[model samples]
Target: MKTKVNEISIKYQGNFKISQAPKISSSVNAAELLYNTWNKDQIGLQETFKVVLLNNANKVKGIFEVSTGGITGTLVDLRILFAVILKSLSCSVILAHYVK
Candidate 1:
C-alpha cells in the first residue's frame, strides 16, 4: 500500500482591482506610467523587473514586481509572472526593467 501525494496548488491573496483611469494607448504612455511608479533615488542603484497587467480595455489591472537584485540585473521567475497574469485575468502585459 502507498500513500497519496498532495498536488501543487496556487493561491492569490489581497485584491486585484481593475482601474479605468489613464489607459495605455502607446509606448510613451506606458513609459510615463511606469516612470511615475519608480523611485527616483533608487532607479540607478539596482535592477528591478516589473510586469504591468492590462485588461481588455487597455486599462491597468495590476502592477507586480517580479524580482530585484544588484546594480546590473535581476533574476525573474517566469512561473511567478505567469501566475500573477493568470490570477489577474489580464489580456496583455508590459515587461519593464530598471538598470543602473
Candidate 2:
C-alpha cells in the first residue's frame, strides 16, 4: 500500500509586466517607492518590517511585508524571510522598517 503525502508548491504571480516594474537606482528611489506603497494611516502607529524584492537588473519584483508588531518593535524570522525571497526568485532585496 502507498501512503498519501502532502504536496507543496511555490508560485509567484504579478499583475503588472516585469518590464513596467520600476527600477531601483538609488536609496532615494527605493525610499520613495516604499513610502508611496506604505499604508498611510499605519505609518506612525506601529512597527512593520518589509522586504523589497528585486530582479537581477535591480528592478523591483514586489514588496512583501514580513511582520507587523507593536509600536516599539517587530520580529523578523529569517526562515520566512528567506522563503519569500527564494520563492519569488529575487536576486536582491532591500529591507525597510517603519518605527513610531
Candidate 3:
C-alpha cells in the first residue's frame, strides 16, 4: 500500500483581513487571528475541536483536529493540544473550539 500526504490548500482573500481592525499590524496576522477565533468557537455545536499552530511570523504551521463530539459528550483533553505543539516548533497556538 502507498500513502500520500494530504495538502490542505489554505484560501486567502483580501477580506480575510480587515483594514478597519487596528488591532492587527498586518493582514496575514489578522487572518490568522480570525482563523483561530472561528476555529475554536465551540458555542451551539458538537464536541468537534481544532487546533491551529502558528509560527513566529504568525503563519499557520499546522491545523489539527483532536475530536468531534456532541452536546452530551465529555470534554476534550488538553494533552492533545500540548502534544501537537510539543512535536512541532510552533511559536503559539490557537484553539478552534470543542464540540460540546
lDDT of 3: 0.59
Q: After superposition, how far is residue 84 of candidate 3 from its true place, in Å?
A: 0.9
| lDDT per residue as tens, model 1, 1-100 | 9999975544434464545356899999999999998888888898999998888899876678889898877899999888888877889999999885
Name the regions of candidate 3 deviating beyond 4 angstroms. 1-45, 72-74, 98-100
Q: Please, what are the lDDT tens digits per residue for candidate 2 over residues 1-100?
A: 9999975445556688899999999999999999998899999998989999999999998899999998889999999999889888889999999896
lDDT of 1: 0.83
RMSD of 1: 3.6
Q: Estimate each model's TM-score.
A: 0.79, 0.88, 0.50
Cα-based lDDT at residue 94, candidate 3: 69
Clash counts per candidate, in order, are: 0, 0, 9
Better of 1 and 2 by lDDT: 2
Candidate 1, after superposition: displacement of residue 92 in Å?
A: 0.4
Q: What RMSD, rounded to one decimal, does every model reach?
A: 3.6, 2.0, 7.6
